[model samples]
Target: MSTDDPWRPRLAARARLKFDPVAKQELILFPEAALALNETGAAIVRLCEGARSIDQIVDLLSKNYANADRDALMREVMDFLDTIRVRGLLQ
Candidate 1:
């Protein structure tokens, strides 16, 4: 897939999302590094399972967070996804 494609996002092969029982937090685990995710980050990552498009994720989240502005939420989601992709944690 093109790196620029935002229609569907997927966790990179080396990365996986898991809940750390000890920390009681969501984490993205890769080879030598792990990222702790906030609630919103976790929610977004969970939807990046290679099935849902960026728009779909934003739509679902907008419903779940009814107070959020759709346009702002989209920008935030895109930024988060871009950050993860740059770190080689997302595809």
Candidate 2:
């Protein structure tokens, strides 16, 4: 969410999601650790491929969740991205 590069939300270079056979679930593995992803997070994380911008993501998600409050949805998306970015998940 930088002014210099507003649209692209890139996953950290060392981070990747994989199917954990033992747990029978999806998890994101970063250089530091591994973390499970909920459905919503997986959806959002999959979209953060550095190809789409924040606004683009909002539009797509809003359409997917048409019944939700647009403004609230936007806020939640921003908050989730911010949280993960701070954790070094997103670059």
Candidate 3:
């Protein structure tokens, strides 16, 4: 279990999640760059609307994906958040 305080993830002010009808996938559009997201990535980012903490997101996902390992989901959420955060896409 992680002892770190939970983080409430939110999309950066300039970032918005939208579906690209041409590409048929969700994209995180910002000022200078856009990130194409797979279904899983879309789902994860959709929850980062500042209303839930990282732990809360994991709990919800674990409930929805009963077969998924909770620990693995936690790691995945952390990694994805870190990746976006590094790129200034997440707050």
Candidate 4:
């Protein structure tokens, strides 16, 4: 899917993402593997629920970090999402 399109991103159907209470960490788990995520990555993944568009995600972050550089944040978020999308992480 095109990032420029209004497509909402979601974790792949075969993947699972959540906070692992026992591990005290966030994990992105596939059938045969799992990825540990930093807090920022975890936050981004949590918001990709196939409900909010890219713009909506940006808006949420913008409000959450009033002092952050909006343009930089946008670029970073888009780049990060694109990388994950290419890795078959996003749907």
In model 4, which runs have C-alpha deviations exceeding 4 angstroms?
Answer: 1-3
Per-residue lDDT value at 42 in model 2 = 75
lDDT of 4 by residue, 3-90 (tens): 4788899999988896888888899898888888877678788899999998888888888878989888778788888888887889
Per-residue lDDT for 20-73 in model 3, tens only?
999999999999889999887898999999989888888988887899999999
lDDT of each: 0.91, 0.80, 0.89, 0.84
Candidate 2: list runs displaced more than 4 Å. Answer: 1-7, 21-24
Q: Which candidate ranks first by lDDT, i.e. highest? A: 1
**lDDT tens digits, residue span 1-91, model 1:** 3234556989999999999999999999999999999999999999999999888898999999999999899989999998999999987
Where does candidate 1 have its weakest 10-residue lDDT segment?
A: 1-10
Pairing residues by index, what is the TM-score of model 3?
Answer: 0.91
- Cα RMSD, each candidate: 2.7, 2.5, 1.8, 1.9
Evaluated with TM-score, which candidate comes out highest?
1
Tens digits of lDDT, candidate 2, 1-91: 5423465887888888787888877778998799798777777887889989887887888888889887787778888888988888888
lDDT of 1: 0.91
Query: What is candidate 4's TM-score against the reference?
Result: 0.86
